[model samples]
Target: MNDFVTVAVFDYPHEITVLKHLLDQAEIDYFFENETMMNIAPMYSQALGGIRLKVHPEDAETVREILKKLNDESNLKIV
Candidate 1:
């Protein structure tokens, strides 16, 4: 069984896209919950707690570090 953990939550599609790209580049496996739901009805994103990025528990720390580095380099924040 894969133990996944939420690393971040984003309300915007573009933000999720960017983070997915970073995770891909670093070869970190991840999945986003509520992405389809958010796409279907953006207004519900807030109520649904936004889109959640999940990763293996073992990769959670690495994912966070990568996100932080990307944010720092781009002067953008992903939460």
Candidate 2:
């Protein structure tokens, strides 16, 4: 995971639901840091710096493109 880099930070798990499926469909190698903790305490998201979407360095650009498309296509903007 050392090669993984943060590509996005979401404040809540609900915000990432569609994103998770998109990432899965794309077969991207990624993980959400602090997701478990955030799920346990959503109020701590700000303190924990949100749930980080970390992807392998090789897939960073692709992931970014995917995120862009997702944001452009839906009202669920993840910024």
Ten-residue stretch with the least lDDT total in model 2: 70-79
The TM-score, computed over Cα atoms with residue i paired to residue i, of candidate 2 is: 0.90
User: What's the lDDT for candidate 2?
Assistant: 0.91
| Model 2 lDDT tens row, 9-64 | 99998988899999999999899999999989999999999999999999999999
Per-model TM-score versus the true fold: 0.84, 0.90
True-structure lDDT of candidate 1: 0.83
Candidate 1 lDDT tens digits, 1-79: 1588888888867777777777888888889999999989999988999999999999989998886787785675545
Model 2 steric clash pairs = none
Q: Candidate 1's error at 21, in angstroms?
A: 1.4
Tell me, by TM-score, which candidate is best.
Answer: 2
**Local distance difference test values of all predictions, in order:** 0.83, 0.91
Backbone steric clashes in candidate 2, count: 0
